[model samples]
Target: MKNIWKILMTITVVAGAALILSTAAFAASDSKTLTINATISARAELVLAPTTINFADNSPTTVSSVSADNPVAVTARVRTGKATAATLTVASANDLTSGSDTIPISAVSWTASGAPFIAGTLNKASAQSGATFGNGSGTYNGTYSFFLANNWTYNTGSYSATVTYTLTAP
Candidate 1:
């Protein structure tokens, strides 16, 4: 009877220890979700019309007035992103030269229209210059007219000069 009671007490103590140890260990769980984002930007593009300008019916005769026979028209097409204004600049390759004599670019007068160049008045420049041709810019088009004066004294032999137009956005 004594042995049985001792063994029974041992088994009950072991079972109680196992129950305590099982309660000591625990399980926990949590869950969450994640999201990601990205973006792309738009690019600006500028295009010009009539890549070349040609003047015709130039007079070589002696004259006292600026003959306006040859007038060439130019236009621009632009596309911009989040820009409010743009500029167009005109440049001459070099002065019209013959031997040692030179004719400055001032001889060519320019006129602009569509909010900057005024519709009817003409603008003249002595060298390379720029003007605002667009406003509130998304995509816009503008026009310009150029005329070469016919009154200048020089040795004549097919005088020529190159002109360039550039556009900028900001």
Candidate 2:
């Protein structure tokens, strides 16, 4: 009887220890809850206006019979967005077209850029403002003017020529 009593006590002690260890285990309830996330951002794009060629402004400008500074200022604009720089090329070969008139302009060759430099402007007869840009809006502008020592030379009856303008990533 005494020996049986000792065996039962030993068994009781061992069982109690095992119960305590199991209770102290790591489990889903005791584990921490974690989280993660992701995000994206973007900006608007830049563009050009007059989006094409324009002749000298007919305002306060005079294509005098023999004046050098004939009011022949062509204008353009750069509607900005996410781009930093751009170049304007005459759209002759593989390019977009704009403008229609008998002012010796054509889908033939591009002359120059005007403003805001979405590309820049080039001059035909050197009028006034060659090329310029708007700072805040990322715009381009230009004017050109050269002297006509003899005006009688360009007085042709009617002419139609094409000028192409291209914009490059500058």
lDDT of 2 by residue, 1-170 (tens): 99999999999999999898888774447566688776533222334333333333222225432222232344443444354433344332222222322232221222243444222233454322223333323434454332222232333333333444443333
Off by over 4 Å in 1: 1-44, 56-84, 98-101, 116-130, 133-135
- Give the RMSD in angstroms, all C-alphas superposed, for model 1: 9.4
Model 2: residues with Cα > 4 Å off, grouped in runs: 1-85, 90-150
Model 2 residue 129 lDDT score = 27
What is the clash count of model 2?
49
Candidate 1 lDDT score relative to the true structure: 0.56
Q: Would you list the clashing residue pairs of candidate 1? A: none
lDDT of model number 2: 0.37
Output the number of the lDDT-best candidate: 1
